[model samples]
Target: MNMMGSLVALLVALIWKPDFEEWRLGWDIKLFARIFSGIVISGMAFAVIVWCVDANGPVFVSMFRPVRLVVVVIVASLILQEPIYSGSIIGTVILVGGLYLVLWAKKKEMKSMSNPVETNRTDRNVV
Candidate 1:
């Protein structure tokens, strides 16, 4: 996904060379700064994702992504003075419920994987 985003960003830069002189910043400098910042932040995000996936399984780590929507709502309400509506509350509740279901399923899947089945045919092959 990061790769795709980077590719699209590059395409946009090539197609739309905006005039930065109007904004008091040099085009080359601003372009490089944007690219560099994107790379750095994306790298850090990917690193954290890899670490989380290593420490906790992918399902557990992925369950947290939905919380970003809640954060967005909070930030919008505080920073942009946007009103929180019933739809936002319903969405938050649904997201939380979905995350809970995923977590419960992961626990059940892990438990089933941990227990081995006992077989009666233990006769022929010995290591």
Candidate 2:
């Protein structure tokens, strides 16, 4: 899936930007460092997400998707000194609330499935 998406993106980029000079890379350490680290980080993140989905199912992994936004916001604010706006705080609050509800519901469902309720029924015989 990842390879297919990457190939499609490369094809689109090639078509959109037909100038080969635009794709030229200079002998710069920073450019190479950024490209290499991005590839490594993306690969590691993909592997971890795949493993998590396999182990805990998609629902469990999906809940963290929004949480990643919150994490990115916080990390950027701290590391990059980016400003945190009121909207970000409000959105984070909403995301956390929704995540809590989902987790609670999932736990309740698992608990019910583990201890299923017994059902009673009566049968009538023909006279």
- Give per-model TM-scores: 0.65, 0.68
What C-alpha lDDT do the candidate models reach, one value each?
Answer: 0.86, 0.91
Separately for all candidates shown, the number of backbone clashes (residues 3 or more apart, or on different chains) is 0, 0
lDDT, model 1, position 91: 99
CA lDDT of 30 in candidate 2?
A: 74
Residues 1-127, model 1: lDDT tens digits: 8689879977787668666554365668888888887799879988999999998778767789999999999899999999999999999999999998988988888888898776789667777
List the lowest-lDDT window of 10 residues for candidate 2.
118-127
Best by TM-score: 2
lDDT (tens digit, per residue) of candidate 2 on 11-95:
9989999899988878899788879888998899889989998987788888988998999999999999999999999999999
